[model samples]
Target: MRCYVVGGAVRDRLLGLPVSDHDWVVVGATVDDMLSRGFRAVGKDFPVFLHPRTHEEYALARTERKTGHGYKGFAFHASPDVTLEEDLARRDLTINAIAEDEHGSLVDPYGGQRDIAARVFRHVSPAFAEDPVRILRLARFAARFSDFVVAPETMALMRQMVDAGEVDHLVAERVWQEISRGLMSERPSRMIEVLRECGALARLLPEVDALFGVPQPAKYHPEVDTGAHLGLVLDAAARRGESLPVRFAALVHDLGKGETPEHILPHHYGHEGRGVALAEAVCERLRVPAECREVGVMTTREHGIVHQAMELRPATMAKLFARCDVLRRPERFEQMLAACACDFYGRPGYDMRDYPQIERLRVGMRAYVGVDAGAIARVLEDKSKIPQAVAEARAAAVADALRAA
Candidate 1:
């Protein structure tokens, strides 16, 4: 049996990025032979083994051929005769197909090194169309490699995949996996743009696609359109380097603008509640993890809470703070502010001078909702004392503030 490091480990090593996980491909090896060598066979449909010592994956050399529809209907052939080049050639992208021997000998059968050097993302073969999931993967890669551009031919092939309805073949879990990665990226806006160009965004997130060209009152929003405004927020969110959930909230924070009534002066009246529902639906559709979905939905629902809290009494402020205590994670709150700022700033022709009130509100929030140790301890104490006279008083004060806002 012969084994070589493959996939991201090799690609990342070449790129000088920190590599945490390593996957190996075992050529000239069979499942029985691996078992005899003390490797535990794990994969049900394919021959995958876990090394007894390192516990890293060692998948047997296999080739895939499309049997019918989509990515699932594939026939796989595993044999000792399959060469490393053949295995790499069947991978989705050139940058991911490079393999390295144990001694660090480079294998570049598909010009992956050249593509990586040129900062280009290109599919390994025309067979890229056989799997619809590749489109999402390609978009995710674009998000990860912000400096890289997809080759024109690869873009055309993606368009062909989109036209063939292959994009719909991806499961919600797979889509969410790619989406989460993109949201965590340094340039998630690139994913949105690439997905839009490839027509995958419209199918996966039609609500977001509907934001395109939706009119906002010119007085408040001088930006090109709602889609453009959202893109700005995405860019800002990416810059913040927030966690995945918070970034997702930022990405979808203004999605409800599409549903704003034409007669509304600002074009986003009551959008917080609408956005919450939209975010919830989108997260559910994508089957996001429960905690992430909850945070995204709650953040969307309470996006306007900060604005509402500005006029509250001290007692009301305490209750508002308590209610949103979990959200006071500084990074997440800052991310939310960044999104809100981007939304406000992105409005076309709107003067920066016009929004001094938002800045003031942010300062007030920082004072009242800070995430100091004392504040967290107070929240924990308050949780056990719920329904007390003081809690009731605080809730009433907060209610009054909500009415005033």
Candidate 2:
């Protein structure tokens, strides 16, 4: 059996990127042949094995045919007769379809090297439409290869897939998986833009898609369009080198703006509280991780408070902190502040702008957290009274800190 290094390993290597993992496509190999050689059979839908020594995945060269709907509806055929070219033909992107033999001989049946050099994302064949997951994958690739342009034909095919209702069949887990990866990529805004272009954004995340035409106060948001502001926020998150939770929060922080009453025009007076439920719905719909979802919810609910920390009364700020459980989940609170900072600086002509409110919140939280609630409870015989005393003490501490600031 001839083994060829395939998929991401070869593609990344060609792009001068770090190859994280290597996958081998074993040509002229069957399940029985692999088992006889001590390769552990692990694939449920197709013939895939673990190498006896290296332990890397070794999937038999295979071709797939669409038999139904969704990404999992395809039937994969793998046998000793399956050719390397056949396997490559079934891949989603031409750039990922390239292979390298054991001797390091390049196999470019689908012009992957050419496309890579051209900085283009091109589909391999008509079979690309078989899997709905490809749409997400293409968008993710756009995020990773920030400079690469999607081929017009490939984008058209993606749009066709979306129109055919393939994107609607995407599972929540898959949708979250792709979105989270895209959020962490080099240029996450590109992923959202691509999905929006292909109509998958509306199907998977209507809450976010509805934000496109929504208006925002031009004075506060020089970008003017809430959707464009969201894009800017996502990119700002990337620029700040934020974690996934912070990035996710930045993405969902303005969901309530889309639900603003038309009569209110661009004010969005109560959008912070309005966004809390909408952000929760988005998190629930996408099955976002609990940690990320919590941060997103907190940011949506308290971003305005965070932005106005310096101006808020100590009691009000203390209530905000208590409501957010800041002392218990300080990291989440920090993430909330970071997301708000992204939102502040995401507008046109506002990059790297100073946000003194964050520092004030940090200092205030530091001082307030030092107040011992247990000690205060010992002084108050009534257990219910202890909460009020603790809150008052914390508020006093925050007031003093703010005054010192």
Candidate 3:
């Protein structure tokens, strides 16, 4: 049996990147051969095992044939006869198809190293069209390697796949997985652009797709198009090194503006409430995690209020903090504020502009977040007065912050 260090570990090593995980492809090896050698079986769909010592994944070299539609519709053939070149041919990108042997010999059957030198993302073979998830993978790779350009032929093939209705069959979980990774990439806007260009954005994220041509007030948004503004915000979030939840909130914070009636052209008066429902729909459809979804929803609903922090009355500011449940999840509240800050400075000329409203809200929340409503209730005979008394104290504290500011 011959084992080679293959896939990501080899690719990243060739590119001088830090290798996080290693995968091995065992050629001329059978299931029993692996089992007798102390490898533990772990793969459900194919022949994959874990090394008894290192616990790294070892997949048997195999070839596949398209049997149906979507990513999962495939019949696999694995045997001692399967060649290393055959297994590499089945990979999506040429740059990822390279492998290395134990003697430090590089296997470059598909010209992966040449493409890497040219900074091109090219497909390995015609079999690339068989899996719809490759489109998302390619986009994510584009985001991670921001300097690499997709080959024109590869882009044409992706367009053909989209036109053939293959992308529509992709499952929600895979879509979310790829999109979330793309969002956290070095240049997330490139992922959105690639998806939009291939028409997958409209199929998987229609709410976000609708924002492209929608107009916004030119004064507030120098970019004018709501979709363009979202891209800017997402890039800003990346530049800020913001967390995933904050990045996601920046991506969805302007969805309500997409639904604004044409009569209101420049002004999105009530977009926040409309945005809340759309954000919830997006979160539900993608099956986003609870922490991420909660911040997204809160940012969608209260970002406008947070934007006008300097103008809101102390009582209103206190109520907004209460509505957001900032006392319980202070970190999430900070994330929400960061998302709002991404919105404020994401525009063309406003990239470096200051939004002091964030610090004001932070200071104001710190002042009253410790107030105890239950403790105040004991001093008042009327139970309803307790809420009022706490509100008053919080408001007074916020008012002091406002005055200090």
User: All models: lDDT?
Assistant: 0.76, 0.91, 0.91
Candidate number with the higher TM-score (1 or 2): 2
Residue 141 CA displacement from its true place in model 2, Å: 0.7
lDDT by residue (164-210, candidate 2, tens digit) is 99988888999899889999999899998999999889988888999
Question: What is the per-residue lDDT of model 1 for residues 114-160, given as tens digits with 9 covering 90 to 100?
Answer: 99999999999998989988888888888888899999999999998
TM-score for each model: 0.81, 0.97, 0.96
The digit string of per-residue lDDT tens for model 3 on 115-177 reads 999999999999999999999999999889989999999999999999999988888898889
Question: What lDDT would candidate 1 get against the real structure?
Answer: 0.76
Please count the clashing residue pairs in each candidate, in the order shown.
6, 0, 0
RMSD of 2: 1.2
Model 1 segments beyond 4 Å from truth?
A: 217-224, 263-266, 308-392, 395-405
lDDT of 1 at 55: 98
Residue 365's lDDT within candidate 1 is 48
